[model samples]
Target: MVFSTEAVMRGRGDILHGRPALVIGFGKLGSSIARLLQAKGVQVTVFDIDPVRRTQALSPGLHRRPRPRDRPDRRQPGALRDRRDSLRGEDFSHLRNGAYVATVTSSEDELDLAELPDVYTRTIVGDHVTRYRTTGHCFYLANDGNAVNFIHGASAGPFIFLIQAEILAAIRMLTREDLAPGIHEVPAPDREAIAATWLSYFNR
Candidate 1:
């Protein structure tokens, strides 16, 4: 969330302060991004296919909106338009100029590029970059519709050590003879032990 938002706001020259943004998912990562944007004073509108997730977003001060309508009411002025206009039935023609669209969904279908009108321009930001442009709106595909934090050639910083420790713990659990074949939780003791080991190493 931080990296991509920085890329768009700082690198791409899209000032997020006081601008409107549409976040298409409200899961853990989505909610985090929405909160971050809101903290920056961006008016955020969120949409999720799941009603429960939509309700969750509302608690964080995000405006909840239903799925984009198939056709936007064309009577509104261009500057007054909202995400519903740009995302109207998956075509981004009506999105407000200067607004941002960030899709943090696991499924690419959440913001299908093929559904976009053919007149827009696309610039390659990276090998797997999924950003697109129509007029003044900037659309960022959070990790190109994949997990944003798991992009290739990018480091997870110090958090990588913790993730490694958790994976090791999970492996140890799998090796245990008493463990069942189905999904199982990694014991808290194992996680604590692994975390302690990392902390001790880093303290040296």
Candidate 2:
């Protein structure tokens, strides 16, 4: 969420404030990104293959829409758009000239570079980070279609460490051979203990 928000906001002026933003997935990370974008006043649209996830994305101010078609609504021609699919040039024809595209999926195939026309400009946003532009459109292939938060220099952050600790605890439990073979809940007491420890360290 932080990385996507930063990518859209940094050096782009206030583009996110009123622009239309699309998030391609609706998993934990994608949902968080959508919420953050919405909080910043971006009109967020989310697409996911999972029906449950798609339903979850229909929040108060966010939109859940189907993929774009060759013939889009002519009434809103200038609206910004985003997509997540194996790139086809025709898929981009519906967007307005200045629209921005960012892909947060795990496959570079999501936005094939070969599909881009030769008249585009490429800019390096960071080490191994690149964005392409043509005419009025900007494209950010977030971590080359991998999770944006896992970019080379990015950290998982402090909160993630807490989750990691919980996972480690779960692993330890599995090793004890005292449990069933199926999924099991992590006890609330264990989570609370970890949270208390984390809070104490954080407050320090």
Write the residue-wise lDDT of candidate 2 on 1-204 in tens digits. 455545544545534576666566677667877787778777777767777877888855678766443222212212222335534555454454444454444545455566767776778775434566666665544455455555535655788879998999898888886797888878899999999999999867
TM agreement with the true structure for every prediction: 0.56, 0.58
Which residue pairs show backbone clashes in model 2? Answer: none
What lDDT would each prediction earn against the true structure?
A: 0.57, 0.60
Model 2 poorest 10 in a row by lDDT: 72-81
Give the top-scoring candidate (TM-score): 2
Q: In model 2, where do residues sit more than 4 Å from their true spots?
A: 1-14, 66-138, 142-154
